[model samples]
Target: MFVRTVYATGDPAELGTAIRALNSEGRDLLEERPGYRGAGVFVDRNLGKLLTVSWWESEQARHNSDEVMRERRTALLAPFAGTLAVENYEVAVFHVLPRPTAHGGLHLIRLEFEPADADQLADAFHATVVPRLEALPGLARAALFLDRERGHGLAGTLFTDHHSLAASRAAQAAARQAGAAKVQMAVVGLEEFEVVHADAHAG
Candidate 1:
C-alpha cells in the first residue's frame, strides 16, 4: 500500500473544528476515491497541529486521487485559512493487535531516518520492533511507511489511552535505539501526535 499524509499547523481555536470537519466531510470524500483503503487523522490541540493520512492500494491510485483530495483539503481547511503540506510513502510493515477505530487514544511517533539495506531493515523491524510492540500495554497498531531509496521513513503507533502510552515510552525508546543500529539509520525528526480519527478494516 501507499500512503499520503497531509500535515498542518493552525490556530488551536480553529483546529478542532477543522478536525471534526475531516471526521465527517473529509472522510466521506476520501472514501470515494479509487483504491482508497483506510484513513486516519491526528489532532494536537495544544500545539494546534493536525495530520491526516489516507491509504491507497498503489502509487498510481494515490496520484490519481490528488485532484479531489486537493479540492477537499481546500474546502475543509478554508475555515483555518492556511497552507498544509502533503507527503507520500510506501507501506513496508503494518502490524496490529486488532483494527483501530476513531476513538483510539492514538500516540504516534514519526521518525525520519537515513536508509541503508532496505530488506535487512525490514527484517529488523519485524524481528525486533514488531514483537516488542506487540507485547506493549494497550497498543492497537503499528505501521511503517518509507521511501527506502530516498532514506526517509515514518512510523505510527496507536495506543489505547494516555496511561498505556506513557508507560511504554521508555521501552519504546530502548527498542528504537536497538532497531536504529540494525536499520543503519540516522534519526532526523521525531514527534508525537494524538489520534483524532482512525478507521481500519478488520476483514
Candidate 2:
C-alpha cells in the first residue's frame, strides 16, 4: 500500500473554512477517481495545524491522481494561500496487517501528536498497539506515518465494525494502564470519518 499525507499550518481563525474546503475536495476525489481508497482529516487542538491522510493501492495510482488533486487543491486554497502553508509527502513506510471478522459499521481513528514525542509514540503503537489490535475481531487494517522533517505524525486503524473498534479501544486503554512508555503523549487531536467510497488500483 502507498499513503500520501499532507500537512498544513494556517491561521487558527481560518481553520474551519480551510477544513471544509479540504474535506469537500477529498470527497470529490475519492468519488471520482478509480484508484482512491479512503481518507481521514485531523486538526490539532491548538487549531493551527491540519493533517490529511489518504491511502492508494500503489504509488502509480497516487501519481496518476495528482494532477486532478492539484487542481482541486489550488481551487480550494486560492482565497487563503497567504494564510496557510501546505506540504505533501510520499510515505516510505506503509504496512497493513489482516484482522479477524468484526461486527457493526466500519470506523476510522485519526490520531495526532506533539513534535517531541512523535517517534516514541509511534514506536509504542507499532510494537504494542498494532499487534494487540490485529488480534481483535473486526479489525481490518492499521497504518502508521511520520513526517520526520516536518515534525508531525498520523496513524489510522480500520475496523470491520463498531464492535471491533470498541474492542480495540478497550485494548488500548489496558495497554496504557500497564505504563508502557512516557513519550509525552497528548491527543493533539482526532477526527472521526466514514469510508464513503474506495477503489484499489490493480498491482
The model with the greatest lDDT is 1
lDDT of 1 by residue, 1-203 (tens): 88888888878889868877887888888888888988888877788888888889889999999877886786787676366888888888888776444555555555555565766766777788888888888888888788876767776778867677778889888778888877676556667667776765422
lDDT of candidates 1 onward, in order:
0.77, 0.55
| C-alpha lDDT (0 to 100) for residue 16 of candidate 1 | 69
**TM-score of model 2 vs. true structure:** 0.52
- Counting clashing residue pairs in each candidate, in order, gives 0, 2
lDDT per residue as tens, model 2, 20-139:
776686667655765677665555435465556666766677777776776677566444334434434434334454443222333333344565666676677767666766676766
TM-score of 1: 0.91
TM-score of each: 0.91, 0.52
Clashes of 2: 2
RMSD of 1: 2.0
